[model samples]
Target chain A: MNEQLAFTIEVFLNGLMAGVLYALVALGFVLIYKASGIFNYAQGVMALFAAMTLVGIQNGQVPFAHLINAIFGTDVHKFGWHVHSFAAILLTVIVMIALAWMVQQFVFKHLVGQEPIILFMATIGLAYFLEGVADLMWGSELKALNVCASEGNCLPQGMNVWLEGTTYEALGYGFFIDNLDIVASIVAAVLVAGLVIFAQYTKQGRAMRAVADDHQAALSVGVSLNFIWVLVWSLAGFVALVAGIMWGAKSGVQFSLSLIALKALPVLMLGGFTSIPGAIIGGLIIGVGEKLFEFLIGAPFLGGATENWFAYMLALVFLVFRPQGLFGEKIIERV
Target chain B: MLDDAKQADAQVDNVLEVNNIEVIYNHVILVLKGVSLNVPKGGITALLGGNGAGKTTTLKAISGLLASERGEVTKGSIKYRGQDIQHADPAETVKQGVVQVMEGRHCFEHLTIEENLMTGAYTRTDGNAAIAADLELVYNYFPRLKERRKSQAGYTSGGEQQMCAVGRALMSKPETILLDEPSMGLAPQLVEQIFDIVKSINEQEGVTFLLAEQNTNVALRFAHYGYILESGRVVMDGPAKDLRENQDVKEFYLGMSDEGRKSFRDVRSYRRRKRWLS
Candidate 1:
């Protein structure tokens, strides 16, 4: 294959990898939205905090003798837990769940029947608080993670399979697809499927749907608002933990990991806030589509960083045609 | 005929007894001030009042919706089937077979008619087959809903939506249904049709009804017992027939002249008391 075409394919593959991560973050947003009708601005921070907590529990901070002596009167990094990646992941999930429960019991429960804007602002407050807590708990340093499977080896390492007298490379050029990426993709797909089944078939799923449809009607039917809120938040927290593990494994766990949540906004915008399938499909489209666009057309004109705004632009264009979303129901206004 | 008469007489026992419930909203404003009423096991009891006279508040208190926001039933108890249900959750109340068809029909507009009906059986732990059977029974009462079963409730006309709401409530298999303003915002023809359906529901299905209504003429005509609420107080209480003929009821509600009031009272009271005793 020619160099130009290879580069295009390479960018496309890379975009798909990043898109999967974005979709993971977006899934967290969708779960919380479905149950509580609030767009959680803190979701990104939840992901960051989970990632940081995992790092802190797995590998202790760098030895700074003066600061450690000043703070704990000893070298604290030497007394680190050094837990396994898998165990750390599980522990992080538990911590996230506890945080979720606390958020619902303390913040959300009191804010019931408040205006939507007020609730949204409260999530913004939660985001800042969580970010500060994460920094204080783990320090503001980046920590690298060992891949759950293996480090320094992509899934398919430069294998070419011949088909019909032509040799087609299994992996793209210049950017080898890591087995970890493939695993992340598979995990994301499985999570999405599980969430879909839970939302459709389970009794709690029906209650969640009822709550999403109308809060007053759900309350009238005797659905506990506080319980459902906590359930959804915990579910969202699990999603954050999963996303944190994958992203932390791929790119070092740090405060910047929270920035990934910003990408999910456009995903939500394109898919509509209430849809689960919308999040998955919209994620894949943004992932695969933007990379290809950036590699081929973007380099020729707009230069680089096309992937940054590609999803938002596509979503904006789509909004002009279908304002609610590709999958969103059209809202009718009654005077 | 004798057995049926005996059964009817036994069923006349009070199914619901409300004893002096006082409801305060936002902890200060008293909506229901020591109000009490009783509904028999197998007929209509009309709660008649003007707007804001606590008719809707009384119905809501029974359903558990009004109590969610700390709207304390300060002074009395509500007995359903001889058990205190004043503090029961809405779902528990529904499961106990006392379903409230809320005012304005509160149909789940985004849901299909069939889905709306399914929600009524939300608290039922019965098998899907039993639920399906109940659905058929509900559709039999309001066939129009069955025809538009797959259609979203938002698209249905006002009268059809009312039918769907009532039909959905019936899907729960409640022994007693509380209806709040079932006649509101409908044409006179549709109102007559709804009242006729309510009568059939009571007569044929043996379901009891406590209906709150503003149309005093029609309410008194259809009800077996009636209470006239004026400014959150029951000013007059008697059998429906007696209330229809009472001088006070005629002047305040029936729009009858005062010249005929004095002569009607004794005859009306005696006839009403005789019907009650029989």
Candidate 2:
């Protein structure tokens, strides 16, 4: 490819990678929303919390150490012992599970049977509460995630090197691609496939679908509603953690890390809130579409940073024409 | 083992007994005022009433699904195999071989016909072979379901949806099935087809049934015994033959009375008259 074409292709590929990250977060929203009918605005913060906890545990940083020092005027910071990446990830998983349990027990248990709007508002409150809690537990600072290290840094150079050597050499120009994006693409593919299998083949997965279909019917058929809700939230938590690791490693762990979750909202609206594959395909569309728009029109006409609003516009237009979304179940209204 | 032995003792003669149960919805609205009924083993009993007669509530109460609707059996005992199950979870009720096909044919519309049937066997810990065999059994009774097994339940017709509901319940291999309004909103021919299937299931499978319906004529044809409820109270109940012939039932429920109807409506202080008692 020529220089301009190579750049465009690079932008498209990068956009696709960004879309995968969005889909990862969107999957959590779909899982919780489908099972519990709670549009969890806290899903993004769950990712932030997971990444923060992973960093804290990995570096032997005491939770609320900063707060403790501020309150008592002490100089204590670290616990003086470092935990490995694998151990940190495991510990983070446990923390996320515990968080899921506590959320169900404290926040949602009392709000059962409430309208979807009320639950949606509750999740917004939960988002703020979780963000605050995460900040207090681990100091509100940008923490770099050192996991998934390829060579010295996680930005995979191999794909770029390979493209430069072979494919790009043929075109007299190389398309730049981040190895992190390549890794994320692989992780995303596996995660989605694993989720599909887990849903299709597992008993718990079947129960989740049943709960999603009709709560009262599922209850009558010997499916425990509360248990299924907890299971779904925990599964969403695990998805959030994987997303946290990938995003945190890509862009350092911070409150802004949670902002990536906002990217998923349009993806969800585009894909339909309840469909899993919609989340995936919707993610890819938003990713590639935004990049292409920015390169072709956004930068020249609107100056830049068009990726922010382009997705929401696309979703809005799509919804106006097709309210059911690309793959969402057709809603039948009975008067 | 002990619980199983106790339940086995309760399981004889009558598969289910709802005794003097008073159900209250939202902690205030009285729905079932001291309603009592028995579902004999391997016998089909129909609870007949118009809308707001608490038939669905009674079914929900027996199936332990009252909690979902903020309804509770404030004063009553629902026994399954002679054990008090009023306070048990809905899931626990199903686990003990009692399944309810809910009103409005609440099939998992998103699921295929076959998947919906498989969901009925969700509570069973039985071997896959037996579950597969039961799937075939359900298919035999409702061959329409077998042909449309891969089709989504939502897209199916109302009669098929009702059949899917019953078929799903049969997949559980329950000792007793609570079917609410099996004839609602279906063509008369389809309603008769469903009733025939219910009767066949009762005779062939020996499954006890407590079906609630407003169509007195069709329900009476298949049901061995019938109860007539008005305003949450069972005013009269008897063998289907006797109830079918009674003048009051014939006039009020079945909408057929040879006697002139004008004088009966014009009677003074008629609320005091117990025509059946007289």
Interface RMSD of each: 2.6, 2.0
Model 2 ranges with Cα > 4 A deviation = A64-77, A150-170, A332-335, B1-12, B260-278
TM-score of chain A of 1: 0.85
Highest TM-score: which candidate?
2
Q: What local lDDT does model 1 show for residue B188?
A: 94
Candidate 1 docking band: acceptable
TM-score of each: 0.79, 0.90
lDDT of 2 by residue, A1-335 (tens): 46787788778888999899999999999999888889999899999999999999988998999789989999888989878777788999999889888888898877777788999999999999999999999989898888747322334566444422322333676666767778788988998999889887777887788889898888888888878888888989999999999999888999998787788989999998999998989999998999999999999999989988999999999889978779786764433
Q: Please list the residue runs of candidate 1 whose C-alpha ends up more than 4 Å from where it truly belongs after superposition.
A: A52-99, A132-140, A151-175, A285-303, A306-323, A332-335, B1-15, B27-29, B67-87, B126-129, B203-206, B247-278
lDDT of 1 by residue, A162-223 (tens): 11122235544454566567668889999888887886667677677667776656655556
DockQ of candidate 2?
Answer: 0.48
Query: Which of the CAPRI classes, incorrect, acceptable, medium or high, describes model 2?
Result: acceptable
